[model samples]
Target: MALQARALYDFQSENVGEISVREDEVLTVYSEHDIEGWLEGVNSRGERGLFPASYVQILRAAAGGGAAGEPPASRYANVPSVPPPQPQVAAAGGGGGPGVGSTFCPPPHHLQAAGGGGGGGGGGLVQLTALQHQASGSGGDDDDWDDDWDDNSTVADEPLSGSGSGGGGGMRFSPELDGPGRYRVSTGAGGGRAGAAAASSSAAASSSSSSKSTATVSRNLNRFSTFVKSGGEAFILGEAAGFVKDGDRICVVGGPHGPEWQEDPYPFSCSIDEPTKQTKFKGIKSYISYRLVPSHTQSPVNRRYKHFDWLYGRLVEKFPVISVPHIPEKQATGRFEEDFISKRKKGLILWMNHMTSHPVLARCDAFQHFLTCNDEKAWKQGKRKAERDDMVGGNFFLTLSTPPTPLDLQEVESRVDGFKGFTKRMDESVFQLSHTANEFARKQMVGFKKEYQKVGTSFRLLSQAFEMDQQVFSVGLNRAIAFTGDAYDAIGELFAEQPKQDIDPIVDLLALYQGHLTNFPDIIHVQKGALTKVKESQRHVEEGKMEPQQADGVRERCDTISFATLAEIHHFHTIRVSDFKTQMQHFLQQQIQFYQKVTQKLEEALQKYDGV
Candidate 1:
């Protein structure tokens, strides 16, 4: 029988692998996590996920098959029996409540129950405090940096019970208006599901909090918010631009020729170098930090792989149509090794290069802040501003200045469909190329090296045989044979070294494009979705359910998306040509150099046997 436990406090699911459990809910404990203070269990409803070990009281131990040896009840005896806090709801068409950092108010029914014992239900809102482990050292600017963006602790094999805040209570979940049963968890106050009208105001309020408080409540909200509501239109958070009022409207600004990119005023690049091993909290936690220096600023800032991951997520959220390249994969094991760190730093460099080159992405406020911010206070301020950015999803189109001349919807649809097919084929081709290149690199390192070594070994053995002869003529032949053997051995080392120069760079470039290819389809879909909405609006107009003016507004929005997408597609093509041309040139040059060295060594070996 599975060990059973009862939840003492309401637990909310924050990340992908966690499950939410209400107070008093029974759970079947599957196993304890490698990280202490967490347990893998299935709740009463059969939903399985990782929850805090502290939240549940184990009624029976699996070994004893009865009550736990230690009284579990006493452990949580002092814990409050209050219900979880209900997130503040924004009134429809009005500004939302204060930032998520503000103290949450309990539900009306819970309040009634607390006041009088007869009216409301049993559940009451309780404040769940996350485990906080203060880093050991003089409190300084380092203390203000929030490093909980990624849950790396779960990867450890040893249970870290005493380690500060292994993984609980940073992200919070609140009930969404779409469904009574559905819950929405926001990494920041601006990203939360609230009244659309109040999104910008709420973000401003959220930014007003102190740096430390902002760091504690906010995280990276990197996902696209494209959920379709009961209404035919797509759901969008309130406008991100503070200047744009609730009722303000926008029009396309370019000429009939189509949308063109405004030249980037600040064209600059960034370098990622010096991946240093860093530790905190008296060495309980350790991570690798990269030195980042932007060409525009010349000042260097230290960032971690997680920081790049967070920045990548922000770029994705901020620009849905733009193809954001993925950073290197996160490795759980051997992360601190030199090879892993070097590869990661190189990937970051490439990713940053692309960010700097793009006119639109280069000018992004969040990105600028990431590249330049060195002060702790400024970092938090920039983070909040990025999180609260309202110009995402459908609203992102609102920020674009499209060609004033209306686009032919049919032509736009055709172009979008063609690009969609291109991305699909490109994704498959890149995957195949990446796989083949990796295999070829592996063979060069192992198979080719071994083959050359085998030949060298045979030559050396022949030299030994020649050495046995006492004749003067045999002496020269023996020396030549040994020299040839040494040359072959050197060739074997060259084969092992060759892949790093040519094949690895090709594979890395392919991997980057593969990430871009993956992003393109979604971006195209977003454009196509807008077209679909336009078609729907036209149908409604035909049926007289919607006015012509409303349909026109829909058409304008659709046109905006089309123009932006077309411009981005053009940009992608241009960049693809330039990147492939440069990379292939370098790849071919390296390949030639590798082969020339091999031939040069063989020629020298041939000269050694000239007399023989």
Candidate 2:
């Protein structure tokens, strides 16, 4: 895809060599290894090298690309742009790039953004006219938006995975608001104007019928300008104003979630004296020891492996969309060592980071219950149930009614192919998972004593996660397929003489969900087949029905499948939640276009009938 340098940039990397790009200089985009915050492009002089992905705005998307579309999203990270800078026409559509797939490939040097997507949507879902043509896109390739797990990226990161906030600085709107390349407002609207007055005084994104009507246009522009300004009231007016925080200020002060850590009780001291001869097995003795430091009048609550394990399960059940960071692994040994306790403490910190990072998980009363609940028995009985609300992950930070900037139609399609590619990988993942389970069913059955219980629980959790993934992919894929078809059908109504555009937003939202669906039927379809092979292999080994050579072959096959499954799961977990977030952002951009169009249409009607 073609891109214009929004700013002057000169880059030299050991991998790609020296290349200088001037502001407004148009160049062809090749690849966006955007996770590392760079772009791959060739200047008009044929000098090709890695340059800052943030330094360019996608003037034109190529035939296929990866990542978020250009237009109508983050202003600093140019994912989406405002409609025409005029009519404010809502562009409700997505999935316009090539179907890029992810691979476990080595990193390319001199990180730079890649190219793809052209003019508009390729498999454009929205066509409002008689001969509706699919919009071209900036081009998406066959690559999926990769997760940052294996990537020890030296550059700044984007929020989530694919279709990050766009800047060519390529970023997204995130809660942390502190990542590199993320945009913020230390100041407000132009000239550091206050929210209300600036909006009242200025005109933005306005249109005029004639030069004589510029003043009227200015007034309308100001009305719209109010919403787009940095730190404007429009962004924060609707934050559940009546909802006060659940606990007292003193409650959250001690850890990453808050400061102060003064109130809650953490296990202070746990020690086991060296064994003295007190057992039948002579010379073996066991005794419990603890020296409690006195501070509060409140009684101390000592938690153990079971309590932590149970809490982990509860977190997994409720926050399926968020990845729970690994807890310190359960060990039969060191149950009472100071070093072990310190390790557990570190694990708790990591766990807290995971829980607190997500908006929904952070606010969970159950999470609070786990951290601050005094009596383990009473809390488990009374407070431990899934906080499974459908409203989880709602963008409360954003004004629900406000529309996002509309993205170009083509850029949207390129994104679809990217999602589809990810699904394909998921399909492979599922087959591998099924195989691993069946292949290892025998080894898993032969019990390793003493630690068997813990091992068994770990396996159960992994299996549950695998099943959960399959369910997520299957459900999302089916719904997406249906909704996308419906969205396509909805487009026909746009051509009606009296357009019933109410369906546009619905269609746009549907398309948005469809684009991000993680299911791949190709792999889903093969699930049964893969499992059958594994069970067969296991059966052959168990019954001794196969020769030694054949048994070895079966084991080898299972081993290969198991390895692939592990890799696939790693990739899947790393970015699935991020993809959901990305999809939602893109959807809002489409909805913004939908709202603007409807608002304009309504206003035009009011003008004609003098309704105002």
Candidate 3:
């Protein structure tokens, strides 16, 4: 855990004990005064040696001037002087011209103009006046910055720190917490997904400019998305419940959203009526048939356990990576056991959850086909239950792990980068969930409520017609359906509790990750600047242009600033990354528990009207 920076070049040692640095390698500076013209450092490989300062550019941002990657210093004409321990600049061969805003001077305007854009003989300075106009935001036209220079080229100077154009004066990006409060930034481009990338980039820039900066977020008022986020989709009763009809595109709603049921929130529950005496025959005993008493349409489908297995198989084939719910273990011997039947019902419910909650697998064509299909012949000819080859093995699924304590910098960075893809998927899932889940839940619940009301009216009419002779059966049936509908209503309430709880944490985490990712690039840039200084010092010593005393003094100061910045960067990043890991684990565990409770509530609800 030493203070470390990335090297920009390869250095060779002429004598033994000299540290040779390789390009793009991260190394730690140990002692500065161990040698003159050469500094002592430890490489990533854990070797200690002396390297000529002229060989590498430091990538960490400096305290006073431009970061290593900032626009060249020549862009600023009247650069202000910065206080002590200025950045070291590598001398270009031929002529040592004006460089480094903190210390190096620029050629006069007359010399720059006469030299025609200041190419050779140390006169390669651009018109500082033009840069001033662009920085002031006064020009109808501005020069496009080029990124063409070889990083090791002797052309001197990084962009001036504290300038209006380039973020300057040694600004650092840090996230600070005030209390137990969560923050989200509103996107300027409304709520479009396209705006997400731009808005995030803008947010990162803004956050880094100050420690108290807030993240920019795209707004999501998507009612359906929010509704499903709360577990409203758990209310879907499947094809047997008569919620879906043929020729419908599968979305979260039980059916399509028309104008009729926009604000309803009643949840769905599917139920099976008691089997008839004829179905109790020895051959049909194993069938254990259940007819879905439709919540919407009257054309309820008859299903048995085998049909569910077929649906499960197709779903696994389609989205193998998604964790499939534990289905009731197949019972070939006790098909008629009461315990077996009850377990099967719960299994079916969990199956629905697995299908609906997943962001990707939830909406697959096979799942839609399973939910809406009612053809008895096809049900009888169910699919094979064997696992698909691709289902169990693929790199597509995210592999998750908890970050270790006390920090391994390389491991931490690697894991963070990996988490980036998964976090992005979470963001997308939340975004999508917010847009459709609420609206779909409301529409379906309202439609079911309205339908239930009609069924109530029909029950009363039928009882009157029968004059109590057959009314008891109708009453029993109506009561069961009512029980199912009531459960839906209660579950809708449960569903609403989740979006705020679940999604807010995700948003917070994304903000954290985005902020961290942003800061990493800045460190590399600053380190490059440090390397540039080392090179300048080395070049001066070798050419005998700088006195021995002056060279020693520059190396000493450079070591202090460089290593100190290195330690600070590592410390800050480690704390934030560790916090990020904790947050991630908390959010994930909460989601798992939330769904488990939801599943239990559903089980209780479904068991209320067994064999009604």
Candidate 4:
């Protein structure tokens, strides 16, 4: 791949001297001196340089930087120096460089630029010169110093049979210097020949260890190997057809890494307290601790991990509804990809977006490993059924979902569109809308019925008491007339002489009626009794036990009248009684015609309604 420089003076410390890598090779710069050790002082090429106040600030932002215009006030210690008045880049269409005449801004100022998605630049082993070593020693290299010094103290090269230690019990060094160019050195512990042998042996041992221990330039080669068998022998798998039984490397893309990548590739483990011995499968040997690294192309496009974390966390805190439980686990080892798919891993949506960028990965067997969780669930159900029928309480076997596989970005795009389509379908579905409306209407009706019963019971009891009072009123009026006939007759005769005074009999009768109505124990007792029932009924309803039958009983006892209907009737009664008294005033008119006519009507109406 062709390389491009990110900044004008991308520098690296090679064995010779500082090398300026400009627009020719992949390069990246770090503000921290320690990164030089890790990257071996290499850099990458891109159109813009993203500035961060501190090394961690830039890294954290790059891991998942916030959306554009978002303030990084807390993570960034220093304010960003904006480029001299240039238009901000739109998030879309490769983040590119500023317009012409723009002066470069320093730390805390982040730049959005276009860069070729070339692999990481070679940060090969650091060439340790004596001067640089003393000034730039990583804490890890301290032990190397002790070991090298110890090696120079050996005395003899005579092999001691089992151990590398010499009979002299000390380190040996061959001291020699080439003429003119190399510095002159000397050996004092043993003979020159023995010192040479010791030095050679030591060199060999160092070479072996360096190969095994020294951090290599992690190759851009993305390979994945899947063990398979063909013709009854072992075979290796690839993105294309399965090959004959020879083990070889197969390249594949990886997923995103969280902010703290150096801490550990996989921080979440299957178990912490439990030993590896407890985690087992019938056929697998050793374990694979999976780590997700973003594909080079996708890294520049989507929101970074750190940004997503911030967004997700902020949303969860602000809106409780977003805090859904049972989110899919990030790490699950020894599990097939198919199993993961069948489990309906929530991340499938995100993973699909990642898959579209790398077409070569579309054919990888690793992709096949991810089992759509739906399929795995169905398979488990089937296996469980068989086990139940056999009644053996024995285990059942089936293939697991595919392993942790990189998704196709194109497929991810399609899946997202599909999800949107599904949501629209649900919204437009007539059955769903109708069902929801029906449920709402049903709940409203239930509430109305409950309220009706509550008020209806009180009215029913009151109506019953009113009817009893009317019956007693008629009986008492008759008895009073029967016992006080002489006095009532005397008053009636005197009132008749002066026709305008006829209202006396009516007023006297009403006064007597009022005395009994005011002191009736029945009215007070019924009102108190109905109130107690109201309280009890409320308790029942609150406890989820109120019933329609109870309401019906209240209605029946109150004469089959609803509360509203009874209220209308009670209002009419009040009007009718008031009108009757007002009309009785006509009986006391100066004209005998009014007095005689009203008296005649009252006697007829009273006799006509005697049974009621």
Query: What are the models' TM-scores?
Result: 0.62, 0.23, 0.27, 0.17
In the range 442-462, model 1's lDDT, one tens digit per residue, is 888889889998999999999
Model 2 vs. true fold: TM? 0.23
Candidate 2 local lDDT, 1-612, one digit each (tens): 234444344433444243567767776555432312345556777876555654655554456753354322322232222322211111212221222111211111101121222111111111011111121111111112121011332332223221221111110121122233321111111111111122222133111111211111000112222121211111111111111111211111113321111222332222222222122225243322222121222343443344445555554433222334444455655555665555455444434444444433454555555545565444534332322211111111111111122222233234334545666675565456445544343333332222334443454454444445655545544443333333323332322211112222222222322322332322222222223343554464465543222223222222222222222233334444664465457656755765565455445433432311
Please name the candidate that would achieve the greatest TM-score relative to the true structure. 1
User: Lowest-lDDT window of 10 residues in candidate 2?
Assistant: 235-244
What is the C-alpha RMSD, rounded to one decimal, of candidate 4? Answer: 38.9
What lDDT does the true structure give each of the candidates?
A: 0.57, 0.31, 0.35, 0.25
**Candidate 3 ranges beyond 4 A from true positions:** 1-470
lDDT of 1 at 368: 84
User: Under the 3 Å rule for N, CA and C atoms, how many clashes does model 1 have?
Assistant: 6
User: Going through the candidates in order, what is the number of backbone clashes in each?
Assistant: 6, 94, 47, 65
**lDDT score, residue 252, model 1?**
28
Count backbone clashes in candidate 3.
Answer: 47
User: Which candidate number has the best lDDT?
Assistant: 1
Please list the residue runs of candidate 1 whose C-alpha ends up more than 4 Å from where it truly belongs after superposition: 1-258
Query: What lDDT is reached at residue 581 by model 3?
Result: 76
Two-way lDDT contest, 2 vs 3, winner = 3
